[model samples]
Target: MSDDVSLMLRASRGDRKAFRSLVERHQQSVYNFFLRTTGHPEDAEDLTQQLFINLYRSAGRYKPTASFRTFMYRIASNLAVSFARSRHRRDGVSLDQMLDEGREPPRHRLHDDPAAGAEWSELEEAYLAALAELPADWRTAVELRVGRQLSYKEIAQVMGKSVSAVESILFRARERLAEKLEPFKE
Candidate 1:
């Protein structure tokens, strides 16, 4: 059994420390998944908290049928889709708004060159904007494959799609992203 499954089993048996360990182990990846999906740090933080809470509540129901990471991402995917829809109705916010306000942590300056840092920042911003413009399914597919480093089959399980469908989504998503980013190549 995987470490996550072991931790989850312990959590199911009311082991608070095991639960906490699981939370610590997976929180950053879950947060990053939401951050990239939602393009808002606050939303990502809230969603991450919600995901763990839901995981804890559902621990007793968890079976080791799938890898725990895949299972958690499936939950995250559903939550993110619901959150996006509700936020869309409530705020009518566009991806542009999210991108404009989304601030990434600064990378270490290369040779202490401010100009290089600024350029990289600008490119990063543009890349994010392009990502946000993708269809939600495509974005999710790409993020799972690239950011989360899931195998295609794993991504398929998370998205509840066939592997071929995931492949097609990723192919189209990559083509679109490349089109958007082509101008940035130096």
Candidate 2:
């Protein structure tokens, strides 16, 4: 059950060890995807756990037609969309409000930063904000393409779209990001 196909087969049949191995192999990538999509560490953690639970529940129906990663990501992406839509039904919760509420280290706190550190932090914040502002599809495409470094084909697979569609999303997303950062560069 070391190989993805075999592991999936076992997990599909209620093999806990196989499921654990699958989780170990892909949990970080799934978590990171959630973090980037939600822009909220706490939400990411919760979503990630839910993703695993969903995976386990769906394992019995798992098919080996594509790479396990692609299958897993498809589920994650769907769940993310559902979660966002659910949140939207309520009063719009800002990304900041949805993020983890954990306290930060004093040194990493913005007010404590030295000039260079402060500048870096500001740039990072701006970048993240820009990403958060993107349309959901574009943002998901960018995250999968750049953050996860998935190829256009892989992205298309995960998105259940064509390669051209994924490329178009990335192209539009990049243009929007550039526009957002233009003022900051000056």
Candidate 3:
């Protein structure tokens, strides 16, 4: 059994420490997923908290048929989609809000040179703008595959689609992203 599954089993048996361990292990990755997916720090924080809360509540229902990482991401993906839908209904803002909001989305800085940093920042902004333009399903697939490094099968499981469907979504998403980023390549 995986370490996460073992922790979850212990958690389901009322081990608070086990549950806390699971949370500590997975929280940052989950937060990063939500942060990139939602493009808002506050929403990402809320969703991360909610994801763990739900996980604790549903611990009894967890089975080891899938890896715990996949299960956790499945929960995160559902929450993200629901959050996006409700936000769309309530705010009706263009997805470009991710890029045009005057604040940069959180990212690790890898360069110390001012020129390199500015160029990298610009590229990151452009990429995010292009990503926001993708259809929701395609974006989720791409994010799961590229951002989280899930296998196609794992992504399909998370998205509740067949592997072929996941493949098509990824193919289209990559094509669209390439088109959008082509100008930036020069």
Q: Pick the candidate with the highest TM-score.
A: 3
Positional deviation of residue 49's Cα in model 1 after best superposition, in angstroms:
0.1
Model 3 per-residue lDDT tens digits across residues 1-186 = 989999999998889999999999998889878766776667888999999999998889999886898888889889988887777532344334644676444332223345664655555766776676666677777888888999999998988999999999999988988876665565
Error of 1 at 112 (Å): 20
Candidate 2: Cα lDDT at 112? 27
Tens digit of lDDT per residue, candidate 2, span 114-168? 6654555444655666677677778788888887888899989988899999988
Pitting candidate 1 against candidate 3, the one with the higher TM-score is: 3
> How many residue pairs in model 2 have overlapping backbones?
0
Task: Score each candidate by Cα lDDT.
Answer: 0.80, 0.74, 0.78
lDDT leader: 1
Q: Which regions in candidate 2 have their CA more than 4 angstroms from the true location?
A: 89-119
lDDT value, residue 108 of candidate 1: 27
User: Which order, best to worst by TM-score?
Assistant: 3, 1, 2
Pitting candidate 2 against candidate 3, the one with the higher lDDT is 3
Q: Give per-model TM-scores.
A: 0.81, 0.80, 0.82
Better-scoring candidate (lDDT), 1 or 3: 1
**Where does candidate 3 stray beyond 4 Å?**
89-119
